[model samples]
Target: MELWERKLKECFGSAVVDKPKAINNEMPGLPRYVSEYLLGFFCEGEITKENLKETNDYIHEHRIDAREKEVFKKDLLLKGSLKLIDKFKVKINLTKKKEDTIQMEIPSLGISDAKVSSDILQSNDRLLIDGLWGMGEIVYNEDNKQIQLEKFKPFQLSEIDLEELIEMREQFSSDQWLNIMVSTVGLNYENYNRRQKLILLSRLIPMVENNIFMMEFGRPGTGKTYAYENISSYSRVISGSQVTEAQLFYNLTTKQDGLLVQYDVLLFDEIDKIKKTGIDEKVKNKLYQYLASGKFDRGEVEKVSECGIMMVGNLPPGGFSEEELLERLLHSSITHSAFLDRLAGVVPGWELESLKDRRKAYTKHYGFAADYFSEIIHKLRKKNYNYILNRISLEGTTIRDADAINKIISGMIKLVYPNGELTDEELKEIVDIAISYRQFVINQNFMINKDPELKRTISYLIYE
Candidate 1:
């Protein structure tokens, strides 16, 4: 075993899994976390053929395929009930006056009008929002021709020891910890250089920090959307879809909160296509306001959300100047200085190679199980690391720029130095990277709008 892999296993133990084995046995239509959860449960060390077969058999029996929805329904009817592991959500039918208006939706089974008990909904209120992955029993009620959700157990780690995680970080060097994290995200650390690895880690900033608006534009197949989609259930990805004010913010008719309020990170994948699908002007206005501040007002509803906004899309095929790249990649509605300034950082995804080109891009070594790693990241979000900013002073930056830089620096500190221990050189390196990220936005802003106010250089002095 490699040195880093041995260190990871020593530090994390059962919390780690063979990432490549998990990927190899990945079930179609299931997130990485779900599959890794099973792998970690069944296989403590290496994934043997016997254990793999058992895991695959369990998935085959529990997970319903899209094409087999009708078959499953018939079986449910004949058996009077069926149990499966799937995403279960509840939809409130306010228009209906009957008590049966609270309905359940099993997307995999194509059943939207299933019945659910008040007790179940009360305990798992998260189902009311975007729902959650869980093992649920559906009963076919002959008297009413209704499918009822009889029981449920959420498919997530109940709790994580945040202090234990922070203490474990002391066991590994900074480089080793970085490698472990990259592998946990299912990437081969050897395939990426130091800067490329840092960019990949930067993607987790939104997951760990609050109200961090960022964008990443690069070539297609660069795995830009991979982390958000597979890393945690706390984030939602909207790709190649039109976003409405009601769906993103709040629905006045249903009086239900939208994706922005429900998720920690709301990512817009293939963001360039969102423009073609057409977004409402009101949605854009509210989005801009929310990006600037975490609060938005719509009709009689005024609410605050700490959800971070992240946009990832592909740049045009041909190479262009930095100014043209920004103008072309960003939707015209949000290409102005106002919206650009709200972003904490802009990752140059073009610097990283596509996973398509690298055969060994996926890590074959052991790393934290996806469920455990996700829970760690979710818990990290509640932490306040802004105190790390006390060690630095900004020069020649507006209040917004400094704030953005501080957020990036704090986020990096949370990811790399969660124990709050760092040498002078380590702190300087993080500060430089943070400045460059914000400076990328500033340079593009000045070039596109030719605004002298946006052209100022951003530099920082480290306090001894």
Candidate 2:
């Protein structure tokens, strides 16, 4: 164990300072001392400089144990040989307090039991969902917690199995609203867990609600393509630069009639590169109709109404302002046409480049779990999940463009949560995210409109 610890420190260098709680917390789940030791090293040493400094400062301020967590490593190897693995199993006993709140304990750890308020647990599940690897794998655990919370609490509980959960989700309440439901009522998982569920739900809900084509648009590394590529074997993502109408929907040239087949998802990477006449007329017309109605006629054969469409692309650097980003590109191409309307949803991409070290990698567990859920959600979609949103209300919801936006939100929720079981709180949050996205678009468009100064700019005038 000592040897392994030394090796890990050597591996990461000076960033591997002693932080006992993190070391102790991770020790049990790791199989060998080597893994735990390396984890500590990675957590400390490989961390970004800011994180390294922050954690170091935190350890010092808290007077945390600075001694090499080498003893914990030795205990791991020695205990493994003794077949005392049971000793390492952390028994997390959680008792229900108020409705949706919990009191948790693990006597063996000699720590005072703690309580999680209903508000805390009920906070947006996405908050819990993070890009971190292990943290995002807690959805199943959260699902389990839902059942336990209902059984133990002496309060009225909503009967929500995965089915009802789906029903609520189909409401299309709004990203913010759905986030709230998932956060408070939905089981809280880590970010990876949340992302997995979000990816699956995002794809599945649309199929269940409208079976209309959907596209995820954003810059690179946002996992837009990853979702279609890795989540389900049934889905396919192809480069927009290379795909032709025939290859995408129908291959009439082949003996098998070109395998003219509809798919669950047909994701287009680099949609901005799609060739068009006059940046709008011919190109926008073809793509727009196909996206909205799923109909397209090529040279020899025509394929109509066959698959869901997801288009992803990168916005130019400092591309117009946020509001103008999507609008500027669209207006430049075609000027507010049907192509924009056919889009069921648009995932807003974060602007700043995520710190390279802050980025996460796909793990075996995340991949498998996501794949499994994708199957489940796909199967469930066959059951018909759609709702109608006639009315919704939220506090302090004043806005410059309430009428049109509210209608869109309501319509989407109806599409998303068909059973009409969406809660008041869930509705509020979804509206928030939805409104934020719309605001982003509108504001960005305003900036682009004001860019008359760029009318003479070479790049602005150059057609893609």
Candidate 1, 186-260: lDDT as tens digits: 898888888788888888889988899998888888789888888788899988647888889889897778888
Residue runs of model 1 more than 4 Å from their true location after superposition? 92-98, 122-125, 273-279
Which digits, one per residue and each the tens of the lDDT, describe model 2 over residues 381-439?
45421232334433222232343244435444443454555566555545654555444
lDDT for every model? Answer: 0.83, 0.38
lDDT of 2: 0.38
For this target, which candidate reaches the highest lDDT against the unseen true structure?
1
Cα lDDT of candidate 1 equals 0.83
Candidate 2: deviation at residue 35, Å?
23
Q: Which of the numbered candidates is closest to the native, going by highest TM-score?
A: 1
